[model samples]
Target: MAMGRAHVSTDRPVAGRFRPVEITHRETNRVRWYADDLRTGRPFLVTRIGLPPDAGDAVRRAPSRVLRTAGIVSRLCPERTATVVETAVEGGFLWIVTAWIDGTPLDDVLAGEGAFDPVRAARTGLDLLDVLDAAHAGGLTHGELSPGEVFLRPGGPLVVAGYGLTGTTPAPRLTAPSYAAPEQARGEPAGPAADLWALGAILYALCEGRAPFRDRGRFEATLRGVDRLPLRAPVRAGPLTPVVQGLLCKEARERPTGAAVREALARVVREDTGVAPTAGPDTRPRGGHSPALLCAGREVSRRAVVLGAVPAAAGVAALVLAATRGLSGTATGTSSGPPPASASGPTGSGPPDSGRDEPEPGGRGAAPAPTGPPGSAGLPPGYRTLHAPEGFSVALPAGWQRLDTSGVSGLAYRVTFGADDDPRRLAVTYSERVGTDAVAVWRDDVEPLLRRSGGYRRIGGIRATTYRGREAADMEWFTAADGTRVRTFGRGFLLGGGRGFSLRWTTPADGWAEPGSREALRTFLRTFRP
Candidate 1:
């Protein structure tokens, strides 16, 4: 196994073709090996083929006469990556194998690079859609689809790897917080539509450069983030706003097919942009450009930025989008690290590193330290949490994630933070709820709130926009709160009557902590029942 400094390891692939179809029931699905390793080539484990009780029998019987009976459906794999090796009866198991993919999975790509550019992201998405459609034609279900199953070839196009794998092999529970389809989490068998939702998530990440949902919560929360949340994309992610939202719909049936998704994305390029898609694997266009631009299908916008130089067609598309719609907010980076971090915690907030809990009191386990006081244990003694004179009380993090108090006599609060992602981002914003129309209310309220928010920080116009449907404002400026040095983009939305309810999603700059604490901030937001 090749182990890297990052603690990840892998085996060097050898050229051969045999694979282990890890089915659920060895008794019924077991493929009595007619040949050993020598004759079998290389072995591949089908991560999943079916659910617990039935997978083994299904897999074992697949090689029997099922394939012939099922017949060949759609062949979605691109020619370069794989050609149908013909539905084969290997040993006693039936399976589908393209060329072996020996590259990093797309899941890692997202974790490493906050998200991907829209063009490339869309291309990969549609490619998978075609594959799924092909399989659907065969009456087979993908069962599971996530970024982890996607593999981005160095020089080749992105290819999905796990097929028939998830159905058989037992899938471990997903613990990390990231975008996932609603059905997959519930243990319900996933179908073609599920795959489309997965594709939309990948596209969202590519355009927005971050998982649609934060991992702060568990399975249900993740489902909500993917299925329920309508928060806008970050300001800089302007081009892809509609795209991500469109893809994140709760109902999978609502999402279009790979062809439709490709067509819609292409339309974004043509209508919003007006250029051909970037070159394919061979850098050639299949046809001039697919001209089926019927986007009444989705209401959200989507975007893909070319990290390097994009195809000439992409530029034309971007120009069209800019002319018709509008290019998103622009942010230039100093060095490209995490977004700026807030230096101070809440006043009387515990020591800056208070949250960085040391060994617990006893060798027993990690114990929570008293942040500040009992009532303000998470908060500081004299300092306040994010409280509105409107009878709202939530436990805000003491130090890193603080409320912006620079408004008129402390009428409002601003918190700034960063996230480690590509196109590096910073979120800074003023907070309050003035009216019904979220956007309009935020527009008219922040200035006056600032007046009530007492402070000496220079007041200037905020030059940012909302993310999702949350009312927010932002600006790229040196934070006057904690002078650790960095560009900042802030946002927050107050719901309910009289700013009694509010929620915030801050992307802090790297290295910098929150105005208070991240967890505390989360608790404060979670406290909101709505």
Candidate 2:
């Protein structure tokens, strides 16, 4: 059995810094305190896990392993992961300090709110899957996941805590025996599959108001039940019944893969939100052009020629292409004639007829650009400025390389940048066949197609704008990409004479407002030179 830390006076500080103010939560082998840092005068949560006296090597390595794993996960998901500020091990106890989480623990929520509806539970399950996907991709397993470790903020996604606890103790199922996988109960090493079992338990608890395997009043007895007893069918799981049953399978090998689970959860979200799934495969090319290009003297509709000339202007086509091949393509407009030397020179026509009033150049009511310190001034560390041969420059984070480029013979070209495995990307496209009204292009040509995407939600009305003194328009919207919700911000403007440039930035929808994401967006907008 794990030893428990002895009670200390409230006035006394731990590790000469954290002063325990009150006990916030307690579990079988762990306890959490609402504490204050005496040195910094900041409030933080302090979690102390009791270690057996004979823990030996596990005890010696617990602090470092916990801190290192926490650091890795924090970087991958800054918004949804708890940031561990400090860790310490002394006298049979391992302590972890983290910033104050402005949310209610899942344990508390279940205790107070009872069983959740299928839709809400599915939303929470999707968030968990996303975190797990990133962690597993990075070669990490959160073996200690439980309802107690998940925090739910009002109007925000869940934030996960208690990473790096899988290997900290010698005994299997040390903290939550009822939630542990059958493999772990049998003394086998826990892995990603074990985490899925815990996720299943959490989902079961959310839908039924109790864990699938109820505790038998003792750790050994509960673990034995987990290893041998059959899972009770969930009565209130509704549409989530199959997923819960699949994940809780006693044989880890029989459980659903992460990708499968993600797809299932995405389907649930779509159903609940009334968003129909895509009807068929998206065969559109990345550049949005048809398979056969138009030849001289060939009869073609004006719209078809314009669309084929610059595939990027086909916004719906671009969305479909992004879904098929990751979001890593450029968008550009093209003229009827052959390619030109400079696509960014000038385009004198207004946007295609969309029945909307076109704003005059330097017009009033132009959407104001985001204000901040200029030109990468507020960029996060590790980003450097990139000067493109195409006469534009922007700052990008380290590890972002040019992923791909597309163009029409000579009239237009687009360059995309990011690591191959990265989910986010930036696309810069220049074209000689631009419409005069940026707002009309987005409203009339772009949005009609974007609406066809699942869960497509326009964040705001298209706004005529100016970028670097040129006529521009800004459009923001949310859509799903490969089962992950994604948000995109596009700004397209004309230099003059039917020539223009467009910049589009995309990131996971759940992380759009994270500090790092905000910094990146701000930097891209402030520094890009057309």
Candidate 3:
């Protein structure tokens, strides 16, 4: 059998009672193990943190401080924070023992999946703010709040860990320094406001698949960037943009208070009906595993619940002309609106009604010659291969043809294909400027712009997947065209060297489960080649 992940180098019993088993989770500077209490024969979660070698009196008194702080916070936030069982200092490390929490760490979830949509991110922020509110009211600061410090229980509930370690060391922050507040990075004392900054960093990572500031590999270098660098504007935050930017203000005093942050997140939850319902009381035995994580009391497959952002949400409605638009300098031509049925020419500039048959500059026509097999192999009925001059090919339905194409030549381009009567569309986008991380590109670059389209609601989280043996990601969502709800499934794969291609298949939401629609999508992904 495969061995479990090990965190500490030795298997020696801690405090001569608790014995570390295997590492259950890991973060920047903290590690959690599935440990056992030798005396009581009970399982526990023992978190280990390294301490400064020469902290003198502070190092000696760390255990007492931890117990005192945990007691204060637990009384204020009952059932929302981990219950500390014991603490001990041994071998220059502080091991905190707590009741085993039956949940997965938030960072682990994000790493396995990808980024969450704005609605879900806002809801999670609200859940986190509840714990912060209670702790702040009790005059306690969770200075080490990070993705690792938070756990997402089955059924959409949240619990926080790692309290009482705020002043354990002389360092401003220990683990996950990328989340340290600007003041904390500068060695200033942390307070409630600093926790708000960490909350903002978590929200940004949820929405964009990355922290506001990149980790510089070295601890000091990362802290310097957190203190000195300006935050890159959040693109996928959408309505939550204001709240994230506000909490990340360099000056702690400028960050929004707990009440303000709560209200903003609540408003977003109220506006978006996609929020997962809060799970009811869990009756599972302590330290026992559930067959599958339940969400809203439904018995969904673990893959569906873990990989998806819960069930798909009903998307918004809007006729977005951006479907045919490409990244700047990636393709040629500039035009808006879906092409008319009879229109058969290269994409042109100006309004949709420009009535011009502008041919591509390089003697290309409305439908470029196929560079690959002309016949559909292993394709659905009536599908044929139409290769493009832009170095990619895919199978299209018999009546389908190039409806619109746009982009700057040699950089990036987007080509849309569809039939006049069919509401479904397949848009292929190729870009040399695309980022290496497919999840980041979808969460940070594409979704933000899509949010601008009216009535757009993402169905699930951005999921990391593989396509044609390349690094790829998939996103599914709902949008509207003339009051009709439409669903779109987009898969983007990296071609190495910052180049990538994405295929987006859109159909009416009502018809998404139809056999034809499902088969068409599978056929597209199977036959597409670059």
Candidate 4:
């Protein structure tokens, strides 16, 4: 049985909602409770951290900041972190409630199992490195990582907690003084480098069966030792000694990056386990037109487009891509005709085309066809055709140009296009890695991530349909940018055998129903040829 600093009487509820059952774990200023939600009658893990008596504004703002950060990180790396259910600050206590995780805390595992072998430690290090890579790419740092914050599922990956607790207290080392980096102990701001140091500390604890810097009787004393004393050599680290030493360096500038750490840990795992490192999902073309051509579109890949503008939006893109395996075999066609008067709803086949010279919705007639090039014959007025070097082509409105392109070598790539001062953009993403069900990819895999976006609300439920005579799904949602509400329509379809393509069109929500926006969407759907 574990002992806690704070006792919970059975009759008294902590926040008038959670009924504490037992103390699961406890640290210097933190306690974990196995509690039940009075409203839902579901079990949850509630953690309470003591705040300083004179926390000032931190007391008022920490609740929202912590919740928001937890939400963003949970969506970005769902498998790597626990889902935060709620947070509150009352009576000098910051209460964080998360979904009950059925796993053993790393601290408990260390206590019961003693030191882990080098291969096991290296494997755990790789998992931590991947999570850190995602968080840092999104500009977040898990500054308070320690053995107690990590939980290992029976056979699943590690899940981290205590993400939003950093920077909430005045003291540099609020709870875990021994884990603080040298810079943090010196009263400096914690950054990505600090996370690296903490990772090293965790690695050390796993192999050595104790923290690099043992906790002194006082917090200040331990932090001082961390700031001044050199790291003791690891006696049982085996292959992990080099990485542990590299990460525990006192000089923050000399620490290796997350990528470097991943490489080193992977090498160690391979050398010790006698098995090659597992490869991630393959995004390479299985069997398509060789030398894929560039396609006309707007914005860059989801990362460059949304991350460049709104950092959190990258979470949405990453979630969608990571959920699926390869691109579908549903290839688009080179059909051409007059644009639809209004945007058609989700359809089962290629985009509907009309030959009539009818006026578009919102009282605007289609612009006259541009007389610039030969392939432009079938394009709508003011639109021209672009054939990319990647073996794909599409028609784009005049003034649209390729903004950016990104992907792994020969596996997957995304091309974006738009013009200066344009509020609307289109992104074409091709992947050799996608799942089987187009609808499930959108609903189960992508929507959870999108929910984290600010002002994110789906226009309607995800609709299953067909594109270019192949299985597809359409999802529409609204988000805010610079105080302007923006809308996006995504069409993802399978091309068979783990190959797929997705077309995302975004525009100002206020103009979503206008003639021009409708025409642009219809034209792209009709002209795109994969």
Cα lDDT, all candidates: 0.34, 0.61, 0.63, 0.61
Backbone collision count in every prediction?
Answer: 89, 15, 11, 34
lDDT of prediction 2? 0.61
Could you give the C-alpha RMSD of every candidate to the true structure, in order shown? 18.9, 20.8, 19.3, 21.6
The regions of model 4 sitting more than 4 angstroms off are: 1-11, 279-530
The lowest-lDDT stretch of 10 consecutive residues in candidate 2 is 334-343
**Residue lDDT tens for model 3, 195-299:** 999999999999998989987766678889999989999999999999999999999989987767766876776677554334322323342323122122222
* Full candidate order by lDDT, most accurate first: 3, 4, 2, 1
Report the alpha-carbon TM-score of model 2 versus the true structure.
Answer: 0.52
Candidate 4 structure quality by residue, lDDT tens digits, 1-530: 01123443445565688765545567667777656566644446778877766667877788887888888787667556777777887666788887765444666666644787776777666666656656665677888888778865422355788888778766665677789899999988899899999999999998999999988857678888999998899999998899899999999999987657777877886676566555222112342311111110111221121111111100011112322322211111100011221122232111111122333321112111111123554345789988888777778999998876767656877677678777777777777767776667777656666666567776545544444334555566666666777777676666667777777667776775566766576456546666
lDDT of 2 by residue, 35-150 (tens): 65665433467888777666788877888888899888876555567878778875567888876553456666666447777767776776676677667656778887888788
Off by over 4 Å in 3: 1-9, 274-530
Least accurate 10 contiguous residues by lDDT in model 3: 361-370
lDDT of 1 by residue, 1-530 (tens): 01011211112111244332112111112111111122322212222122233244544544333233223321323321222232333332234433223223555445434555555565555545545554554455554455555544322234444344334433322222254566665555667666666666667666665566665444455555644566455443445556556666666767655555666666555544566554222111333322111111121221232112122111000000000001011111221112111111222111111112221111101011111112333223333344434343444332323222223234443232333332223222222324433333323543333234222121133322211112222222232223333332222333324341223332223432332333232233223221
As a whole number from 0 to 100, the lDDT of residue 360 in candidate 4 is 33
Query: For this target, which candidate reaches the highest lDDT against the unseen true structure?
Result: 3
lDDT assessment of candidate 1 = 0.34
- How well does candidate 1 score on lDDT at residue 188? 56
lDDT of 3: 0.63
Name the regions of candidate 1 deviating beyond 4 angstroms. 1-99, 111-114, 165-179, 186-188, 214-236, 257-259, 271-274, 278-530
